[model samples]
Target chain A: MYWEKEIETMDREQLERLQAVRLRETLERAKKSVHYGKRFAEMGLDIGGIRTDADVEKLPLTTKDDLRENWPYGFLACSRDELIRMHSSSGTTGRATVIFHTTRDIGAWTNLLARCMYMAGMRRSDVFQNMMTYGLFTGGLGFHYGAEKIGALVIPAGAGNSKRQIQLMRDFETTAIHIIPSYALHLSTVFTEVGVDPRRDTKLRLAFLGAEPHSEKMRRKIEDLYGFRAFNSYGLSEMNGPGMAFECPEQDGMHIWEDNYIVEIIDPMTLKPVPDGEEGELVTTTLLREGMPILRYRTMDLTRIIPGPCPCGRTHRRIERIKGRTDDMMILKGVNIFPIQIEKKLMEIPGVGTNFVIILDRADYNDSMTVKVEVQKEFFGGDLRQLEALRRRIVEELKSDILITPRVDLVEPDSLPQSEGKAKRVIDNRKD
Target chain B: MISYQLSIFAENKPGRLAAVTRVLAKEKINIRATTISTSDTFGVIHLIVDDPARAEDALTKAGMTVSLSRVLAVVIPDQPGGLDRLTQLLLTENVNINNAYGFVLEGHRKAVFVVSVDQIEKAEALLEKNGFQTLDAEALSAIEPFHYMKY
Candidate 1:
């Protein structure tokens, strides 16, 4: 059940000691780079004063805007020649945030991913089909190397091409897959179109889902449709994608591997650590990354440390699945609404398809939200009254959950806008 | 027997109908009659096409939501009260019409009034019993609206 048994079950105090040593080493490496070097010097930070991982809280939180303003090399902790690979966010919203990795850094990331997979029941005998996009985006290569390290036959079946993905699964007898949650839900329709019930026709037994934060209901829906144990993967490119934290077989919450990184949950407003079980912004500091040392990076992702110990015996503390990114929240009429909240409610209503778009508009000094939901083809019937009722029900349910009635438009399946690999769920047309 | 019409879901925006028509025109499916029912932001385009199954398949492949709905295509007189007579009969039979559209095949002689109703079987029986002629899918698709016009 353990990957690196000694490290996996390391005593909490011992782990903190190891983290302190790594934190110092990381700061040392970070000082070598132009970005962190200047900041550390200007702030008069004494790396020697850091005795334990808890000392990370004293350091300032690094934001993505800092990474962006610094651009390509601001966050690099090592020399340019020391870098072996780099992965970046899409940068659609702003300047792309890039994370570099040295060879040792790559090796470290691979080991963590391998540990994550092993904890989720992946083994050497498994044939892993990685469905994430391969280039630039870290989701593909991170898991690709990790699955390979586990001695699994790695099928780097990149994203999309659902038909070919299915054929390859059957042709290669693939037993495991890594995919985004939305794409996984979309692929189920293609499975039916090709007369392939994944549960019966494919050898798939495990799925690792990530890249975007999806609700627990979304995970269970994919699990039921694919007839496999779906594991929730948590990671951002800043924290070495796909391996930051992962769900064990218990499936209660994701165990953030504290061995490689130190984590904190803080209120976004006060910038102070919240209670252990309270939901707050996740601030992470890389203890192991060498190519780039990000110190107390304000992840902007919102989640909480689960209060109790997990059944899975690894002492690494677990975190509840990411609720939503602080960046993804929208304030409509003074009430803050996360797209995930609407999604969580949408998933509960049967006949609502997986894809939806939240459009915000302003007119006459008042803000209005319109949710365009894709109606499942199976539920659409000849009667207009039934469709109208579905529309009203969607609006009513969303109103009760979101505290405001949003105009719900029932659209055709696959009609909502999508960009890159992830769907552009919200279109904020309101001008300030 | 009840005939079928293709009902398509579309956002209320320019070029939506054009896109639908382009798919039908590309597939060589002729439209016999069409009507649009719209709400605030979206609408449904109900079409009596030459072939509904093929139209549905083509439109769905083109990424449009299309459904086949049971409708009665009754031949009525081309006079002013032709539609009123049919609706009155439907009202008398307690058969509510969800959607209805009509087109004249031959002026002053015959016209077709198509209606989508909840109690379809009952509507068809009442219409037939009341000396009204209901067209089947083949006859409905074969209709040439305004073919009698010399213009």
Candidate 2:
């Protein structure tokens, strides 16, 4: 009944035993790398002493900075000849973090993604349309191989041709799509403008949304608008792009596949593990990978492990939706704020559209925040008073939630700059 | 009775008005009069055009949020007291005007004052009862503004 029923449904005791064995193997492979070899030698890490999953705490946490400091092949465990392909982070800020994969590593990643897609109800008969751009970014190829492994007819329609995307949906009877949440919402408008109601015209019933952290309300809005069930997917390039954790049919939380990786949530300040059900940073260690096996890699994504067993019977532990990244947290007036907080509040309001941007500036030693939201066309009745009321309502709601009064600005529909990839939601103009 | 005016939602940015005019120009739609009112970050452009329905369609197809609203186009004498007389009647009757724009058809002879109000039928009835000559869409669009001027 499952992709790998034996592994997927392995009990906790058996899973821990399997993880202990894989942990030792992963450490042995990690030791072959130049970066981890010196660190392990310095810490005198005894691979034999690591007997259980809890023993992962002994390993020093690997960070993005460490990956950048090492540069290209510092983390490659296997010989250069064994490498098949490599994916790198966009490196918009600093040095790009790169990860190499052997043929076997690619196979393991493909199987893991297949398991995830199957768990989300994708089938062999389904025609999957992958709308993500395939490049150094892992989202496109990772899911593409996985969907193909499931025997689904894969239509690799890369991002940003709303008219062509709709035409493909109609022509191919595309039953499923892998898209970012923002692009999914943006495509819904095109469906109407092109006079094709997806609910009636296309056979699309399933969508896989990932690559960007989105709210539950945003998920529901996409589902309601497109008349499909959108499954939230969580993954990073360090952990092989998008098959890290995925929502089962229950939709309670995503189950992190523990067979291939060990997951830990830790306090960012203390760098210590937080108990299950408490929010903290996600640290992961990859097993079953040959080319580059990361040990205790700090993900910087904030989420908590959902305690208790999921009704889907997958013994793997579940994780809550990623709240926000540690680096993306905005500190204003001695208070912490996240763009998702404003986005969540705006989604609940009736007249608010799918697009918004948060601008930060400072004047007279005071930091100020301004949220610009697009006014929905249906709600704009050519009345100034109604628009003013909507703006005031957004400000009040945002203040009540974020604990600071923010200046709200309403703009024309689709006026904000939109990217084909993850939406750029913040613009910081303050000179720090 | 009531004439239609195209109201467009726009951002307060450079070249936005040019973009709007480009759309209308491509469609060969003539603008009778136009008024733009801006708030902090956005503005609304209200246009009295020759064919409001066609203008709205063209602007919307060009990806602008355009809405057609019912407005009253009242004919008044092209004199200083012409608009004052209309305002006095509206003030006494408590008929609030949300947006208004005017242009003289013939200098010192006649002018058109376009006013957008919430209660269109009531405003129209009150204006007619007050002996005010209100123009419908056809008459307002057909007005020959500055036709009496010779260069």
> Stretches of candidate 1 above 4 Å error?
A91-93, A329-432, B1-151
RMSD of each: 16.5, 17.2
Error of 1 at B144 (Å): 36
lDDT of 1 by residue, A156-260 (tens): 999878899999999999999998776787788889888999999999999998875667887888899999999999888888877999999999999998988
lDDT accuracy of residue A250 in candidate 1? 96
**Pairs with steric clashes in candidate 1:** none
**TM accuracy, model 1:** 0.60
Q: lDDT at B120 for candidate 2?
A: 80
Tens digits of per-residue lDDT for model 1, B4-107: 99988777889999999999999999988888877777778888888888999998888877789888988988877877898998899788877878777855
Error of 1 at A424 (Å): 16
lDDT values, one for every candidate: 0.84, 0.85
| Candidate 1 chain A minimal-lDDT segment of 10 residues | A88-97
What are the per-residue Cα lDDT tens digits for candidate 2 across A61-157?
Answer: 9998889888888988989999999987631222347889999999999998999899889999999999987877788899999999999999999
